[model samples]
Target chain A: MTEERRPFVSARTVAERAGVSRSAVSRTFTDGASVSEETRRKVLEAAGELGYHVNHLARGLRERSNIVCLVVADMTTPIRARLIDVLTRKLQAAGKVTMVINTGTDEQSVASAMRQTLNYRADATVFLSGTPSAKLIETSLANGQQVVLINRDDPLTGCHNLGVDNEMAGREAFFLLRRAGCTRLALVTSTAHTASLIERERVFVAVAEAAGLPVAVMAAGPTTYASGYESARRLFGRSDGPDGVFCVTDLLALGFMDAARHEFGLTLPDQLCLVGFDDIEEGAWESYKLTTFAQPFAEMGDHVVDLLAAPVPVIPGRRIFQPVPIWRKSIRASAL
Target chain B: MTEERRPFVSARTVAERAGVSRSAVSRTFTDGASVSEETRRKVLEAAGELGYHVNHLARGLRERSNIVCLVVADMTTPIRARLIDVLTRKLQAAGKVTMVINTGTDEQSVASAMRQTLNYRADATVFLSGTPSAKLIETSLANGQQVVLINRDDPLTGCHNLGVDNEMAGREAFFLLRRAGCTRLALVTSTAHTASLIERERVFVAVAEAAGLPVAVMAAGPTTYASGYESARRLFGRSDGPDGVFCVTDLLALGFMDAARHEFGLTLPDQLCLVGFDDIEEGAWESYKLTTFAQPFAEMGDHVVDLLAAPVPVIPGRRIFQPVPIWRKSIRASAL
Candidate 1:
């Protein structure tokens, strides 16, 4: 770990090798800095030979580091993985490097992630998952870091909020199932109870009960495919099982569909109808054809980058996006 | 964009507020640095009030950045996403931050990503996808950055190479299909001629042809589900379609299976047999149940971190890992 283990080639070495001034070598590497084309070529060639690279860490200390931190958890999950991909690509195109702080689902991890975001002095910190304390958010704001929260309902000040319209999507799911003549309704969710999941479950249950329908709910485990499969086993083991189901996520829906078809011998849309949230790519496979709501990842990614690239700190406020429904064979066509 | 927009709190502010020397504030934040307990407590409280965050960028300029760059493409793919998830979690546990450079399958993007890795002076760079030129590798090595290439066969010096035994897996897949009494065999791959996919296709075709079995090869599009579905459609459209198919990836196999069952009305094992590479989580879903080879992500992640954490730079060499076969129900039990 000693500094002498690896000797860093400096601009002085490149300048000496190219027979140019140190300022000429620096100008060649710095964007928008003026240097004659002939001198730039010579400097670059020398730098290539000497393995001299402009130190962005030093530059970042003098100015704003074009680094964006994504605080996330369960990054292997379909939806979260897609989110990170879109965000990182979009941010890179906007001249920002993404530093992912994987905060496992725990309060201590969330705090540690926030601390890392501050330690790096990133230009912005995007909370893709896990809720940070208000105190942490305030500290980040005071350190001049722009904060953005995704799919979270917390009303922390001085931070931009972006979320999907889960309530609307959930209500629509209930109406879609009921219109298809489904009498027995059930909701399959997970123990995570994230803000988006809670919102979806609440609206679906409220709408169903308001229409004088009893809705069964199951949250046996975390939001994963296996949990959904277990929930299906428990729910459909009875003679009077639900005819229609609403799953909080596409992964859960796929698992539920598999268990119902293979174990319970129920055919989709004929013996049982299903709808899911988050139109993950898996749901669109020929095997599933799951009818669900699409979270606009591309649009959300663009919006987040725009907020970060703004010249001045834009007024902090919530930006709610509507999730569009994708019609597929998982639900009865009559419901459409 | 102006500096006046957000005022960053400094250690001086905390020191002034706590009536302590500026060095005391620094000592309190620096890990393992000594300060009186009373001064440490007072400094922390004052720092919390003033929101002072130590800048790692400045510290990085003096020594190592503790940043590991992951140059990758197609990060949203199941196996790649899982790889990143495992690598990031392990690296973070070892006190390193991950910087993902998303190099879209293009030469220019790959070159740009390499330049960024050098600019940041990352302690190590792991190439997860898209091969880099030998000239780039040489430059990185000269610049004192440890480099690791995954699933590549390039004989570049001064860089560590890690890859799966794709040849063995492909050979085993052919024998498994043959033992299951599948006379006609096919290999389903993608247009993206990555080293792993090419190796898998090569060994499978060579083994089958050596056994006097003619093999059909179809690489319709990119390595995706849609391409797999299209491959299956074209393969099974003929009257004498292959009964056993070996897909280069699980995603393609799943698509092929769905198309065979739904489009061609073929039953599993009875009418068709399948094997695939990369035992992604989705392959084990109740629907697909794909028999495939596991990439050993956790072990590889651990190895990458261990290489980076070495006090002295370890000698650069190649490390080949064997892919373990996962026997799922996609193949007939008679193959056992």
Candidate 2:
């Protein structure tokens, strides 16, 4: 490679240029290391002239890399994108760099992502999605890397589990819809069957069943806007359709609302009432104004960073955050 | 760290356990290194059992890190998010990890992000946003690192510049609105005068001036939804507002449309015509069928990866991709 042909500027070069010892140059670069102000100025000036950057890779071998790996699937999704943005900014504030591993909804890819975390010797790994193998978790723990799982009930030992209360949100959605004076009930979900989605679906269905209300559950396709649109078509195509619907995601809810309005000529709250999970920014748009459960992105990010910043290996435990209820025009005022 | 208390499993341990030489263990772990199949299998088994991961940081000191740094600002913005998603997925497929440096629209952050690139010895650094200093570019080139600037007109030597044809898109927007028989014209932009935004605004204003048409420009705040909404309120709040509006971004256009429709009670295409840049996914939503110019995200990502994969340093030049026009309900039929 052409890079190899050029000699890499080392601390020795900086030291000679600054007329200082190699150790002084090293101390000047090392974080929190003590160095005289005069020596630091000299070293920095010389280093700047020589284009000498501290080899963080080599330093990482001795100490922590301060790199955190985020293993995520479907990163382009609105909710996921928002979550990543929050986590990355929070981690950066904590003096850690984020390495995003896009494992596209596959177990094998998730395993590979975990392997990369170990390869880089990342200080921590946060799983925003995908189910990693138990063996990989064990390997990560053995290598001194903290593993944090979000919105997953994997019951894996030696990892922090942080998730929203999906069951509570689901139950609340049913109650909110019922309070809107809707008789027929339905649930719009996707075939993804992720832990959080499944939990929300199961609880909502159980709540409606206990109240002697018939509920139609549809998993038309993957958790996407198209799937929600398809679900609306199938459900509302019938003469007797749901008057109250609870969607597992904001994307799905928005799609269902559009198809219901434009295709079926149904007005929200009058002909149909809808509740969605994950209060994404689009949900608050003047057009959609979707009433949904808001995931505590900032709070969750703070918790993760706090765990990583701990001086000692943190006690691995479950930290369930409550999803805040965001009321908009999608649901009737009576529900509030 | 508790990790230091536990002895790190070394290659010697793996070699002894596998009944192979140290060189065999090393070769088995190193990519493209020659090792017998049986020896490789034995080494892997021993390494897996012992939970020994190859220190990629140390390996990167000798070889390339295979890390690509992406310096961006406002990553949560729809267009930036879409671009990042495409780039990360593509880079991962090419066996490189993505390090996103969120440089928050500040010059200092851009410099720090470049330093991080040098510290990690990334194979390449792509500036998705922010204008890095010429001195940093020279240092990066001197260190044999490929620098690729996107959507920036900075003629820094030794760096590849790839961007969309903002001038063409801006001019096309004007003519499209003119074809719709809208005499009065205005441009909805933001206070964040990035290179692309400035170019689009400049060209659009120049084109209108050349046509002897008065153009109203409003930059109430940053390039954001709220800013767009505020701009629309300010523009429409006036009685003699322009009927034809060109928004520099889809986000701005969506917000402008929402405010015009809900607040000002303006009907689209009949009372007003709108054009936007960046055909983000949200722009295609049923509520906001926004006419926009589509940025070639996939093509740009392919070009970046190809540049990084070149065997030798590529000749630094500009590659401008044409933005494709997306017809939607926001523009009049005559415009099509």
The TM-score obtained for chain B by all candidates, in the order given, is: 0.95, 0.95
Chain A (alone) TM-scores for all candidate structures: 0.95, 0.96
Q: Judged by lDDT against the true structure, how good is candidate 2?
A: 0.89
Off by over 4 Å in 2: A1-7, A31-41, B1-8, B31-38
* Model 1 chain A: worst 10 consecutive residues (lDDT sum): A1-10
Total backbone collisions for each predicted model: 1, 0
Q: Give a tens-digit lDDT track for model 1, residues B182-256.
A: 999999999998888998999999999999999999988999999999999999998899899999999999999
How does residue B138 of candidate 1 score in lDDT?
A: 77
For model 2, name the residue pairs that clash.
Answer: none
Give the TM-score of each candidate.
Answer: 0.96, 0.96
For every candidate, what share of the true interface contacts is present?
A: 0.72, 0.59
The C-alpha stretches of model 1 lying farther than 4 A from their native spots are: A1-4, A18-21, A30-45, B1-3, B11-42
Deviation from native of the Cα of residue A265 in model 2, angstroms: 1.7
Lowest summed lDDT across 10 adjacent residues in model 1 chain B is found at B1-10
DockQ of all models, two decimals each: 0.73, 0.64
